[model samples]
Each structure stands twice: as structure tokens, then as C-alpha cells.
Target: MGDPGGTDYAVSAEFYDLLQAEPDRRRAERWFAGAAGRARHGIVDFGAGTGIVTRVLLESSGVPVHAVEPAPAMRTVLMSRAAAFGADRRARLTVHPGRAEDAGLEAVADLAVAANVVGCVEPAARRALWRAAARALVPGGVLLFDPPPVGLPDGIEALEGLGPVRMGADSYLADVTRVPDRGVLRMVFDYRVERAGLAVRGAREEFPVWPAEPAVLVAEAAQAGLELVAAPHPDLLAARRPHG
Candidate 1:
């Protein structure tokens, strides 16, 4: 939840399920379903915004889940949904309030999944986030996430500057701040968006953010001591921590 509206989560959260489309959702669903088969103890949803994926993990595995979100607004939604899953019982879900960089998940879970999170910080912050995720895992645990592919067309970056991207009555656009480094570009895109059919418009800004290339993500995970289990793609990426 770490400030999806104001953060990288953005209007993507508002129309998240919609824009994610069925195929993409199924892909992620399948990925977690597979992960559930491998994870024996517990799982941590790194960004856990709204708990969409968190619920998926719980339903798929019924293992312990820690839904960590930094954004109060998103966390509220997550807690509400957690109740639906009987998460209030100590046996099920645990909610943690913090950003990925400081989530302190180490030895707390058998696996950690970042989903679409982790790409919303500066390069240093992004690396730190990955390190934190790796630390949160037990040996042989996994970290899974898919950030937007790097090398965005120059036009896309240009379009980003032309106010917010308007779809229906909502605007998914925000001002961007970028710091370029070799192949990596650290950036933050703040979005003020409204739901397509809903009457309420929620506004917020995301900061301390950025995106990275798929290869860079893998290397960073490796640097964090996670073996690349799935390389980032338009589809998915999965990585594992080897058991000693």
C-alpha cells in the first residue's frame, strides 16, 4: 500500500485490476500458485497494497502472511479485506506498517514477494529495498516482483511530461523527477487519479522513487544474495534464496 496513489502504485491501484487485465492477473495468480507449492512456512507481501496479491497468497497456500504496507490509506483497505479472510486470528495474517526499505522482514518469512513494488525509489533506495527483501527471507526463500520494463521509448517519457495521462474521468499522471546513471534512471512519478466509474477522486503524490532494467533487477537481487529464479519480463520474474 506504500502510498499507491501518491506513490508508484498510483492510479494503477484505482484501475489496477482493470488495466492489469485478465491475462496479466492470471499470470501472477499462476506464479503465486506455483510459489505456494514451494513455500512451506510463511510469506510476506512486500508492498501489499490493498492486499490483492496477499489474498491470493493466503487462498492459494493458507500459510501465514504478513501484509506490509506503508500507506495508511492502502493499509486500511488491506485490513478490511483481511477480515474477510479471517485474518484477525493470530494464525493467519500479520500487518506491518513500513516502506520496503525498512520493512525488516528477515527470518520472518519463508518467501517475500514485492509484486509491482520496489521500482519506485532512487537507484540507491531500490537496491536497499531489494536488500531488505532478501534479508526478510529465510535461507532458500524467494523474492518475486515485476517492475515496468526499462528503456521506455523516449516518446513515453515525453508523454509523461504532458500532464497526467487521462483515461475516462481520471488522470494517472504526475510530475516526475529523474536521475540518470549509466543504464539506470532513477525517477518518481506522482499520480492524482480518480476511479473511472466512482464519484470520488483521490489525490496523492509519490516520491523517493524510480525504475530499473530487468537485467539490473536480476543483478541487484543476486547482489542481495538471491539467486535469479525468474528474470523480469512483460510477464513475471521469480528468484530464490538457496538453502544452506
Candidate 2:
């Protein structure tokens, strides 16, 4: 099943970096550093939106990185950011215009990562994604990713929100809605940009996420020929392809 919301990132791309700036940076640093310590060369980043994680991996290691992303707007931004890198760094990066399932990458990576992308894929496509990740890795290579929290929190309704965060002349509010039957979380962000003391511009975008259970993910990985391993961090899962 495809994403029903379509390319909402085309609209939210303007604020994507700003909204996720610090947290994504820190996450990229921590995750890529760990991956780099183990993998000797070649890293593949699936769903490499805006190249945030790609940049971190490039800087953390001298290994070649294949950044795979499907969204046109996100890929444009990622390519633009990668162009800013030095010749040596830029030469080490290759942008793949496809999703994990059709990335057409060689099975040579020592490490593969999906970061927060797993939740974005529909449940039916998740098994294929795991298989593709397995195909992209060398024997004994590692795959690391973060899955969404299992089930709903107690006492929370379908929708939940907090106060808006203001940055400069712009302010934004975030709301998340749980669709239990579909196993998806729909996140909406409303933004208002002020101009000449007037709130002249506004945008509302929705991003739907499908979170999988840990047990289910482990089973999927096993079907993809990956063995679930203990992750160094609690927030991420590590799976390794069998050496034999």
C-alpha cells in the first residue's frame, strides 16, 4: 500500500530542517557514530530525507554512502546540501532516486540504516523493506533502525497536542492522531508565518506513520535472513545478516 497522504513533504519541506534541526542532528551524530565504529566501509541510508543522516554518516566516516530517497522535494534538498560538501566528501556520496525496495544498490554495504523512516512505510510494505535492507548488506553486515512505540498510551484519546512553539516570526503547533484500526499515527502541523505584524501565511500538513511491534519486526527480519541482535542503544534495533 502506498502513502495516502502523497507528497506533503513538498509543502512542509520549507520548514522541515528548521522544525527537526537540533534533535535530528543529535540523533544522526549518535547513530552514525555507532555504525561507523563497527562498519569498515560503505553505508546505505534508506529514506535519507533531506540528507540529515547522510551528512552525519559522511562526516563520521570516510566510507562511501548511498543515500536513497524517493520524494522529489526531499531529494532536491538533499542533493543541494550534499553539493556544499568538499570535493572529497561529495565524491564519496551517491544519491539514489528510489525507495529501499527498488534502490538497485549493490550488496556491498557494511552497514545500513533507516532511522525514523520505518514508521512511514505501510505495514504491507515493511516486509519488503526489510528484505531490501538485507539484500543491500554484505554477510554479517548490520541494519539499524528505530521503530515507533508499541500500542497507545493510557488515557490518551485519538488526538493529542501541546502548545505551539514560536521561532522568530513564525509559530507552529503539532497534533498527533492515533488510528488504531489502521495501525497508523497521523501527525498534523499547523504553521503561521508573520509578516509586517500580520499573520499572512499559513500551512497545515499531515504525515501518517505506521508503527510495528518489536516481535513482529523480529519475525520479519528473520524472514529476511537477518538475526536480531542486542542494540547498544535502547531506542534502536540491530539486526545482522548471517556470515554463512
lDDT of each: 0.64, 0.74
Poorly placed runs, candidate 1 (over 4 Å): 1-27, 87-90, 157-209, 230-234
Of candidate 1, the 10-residue stretch with the lowest lDDT total is 153-162
Best by lDDT: 2
RMSD of 2: 3.4
Candidate 2 lDDT over 20-49, as tens digits, reads: 756787987876676765667689888888
Report the lDDT of model 1 for residue 105: 67
The residue-level lDDT of candidate 2 at 168 comes to: 64
Q: What TM-score does candidate 1 reach?
A: 0.69
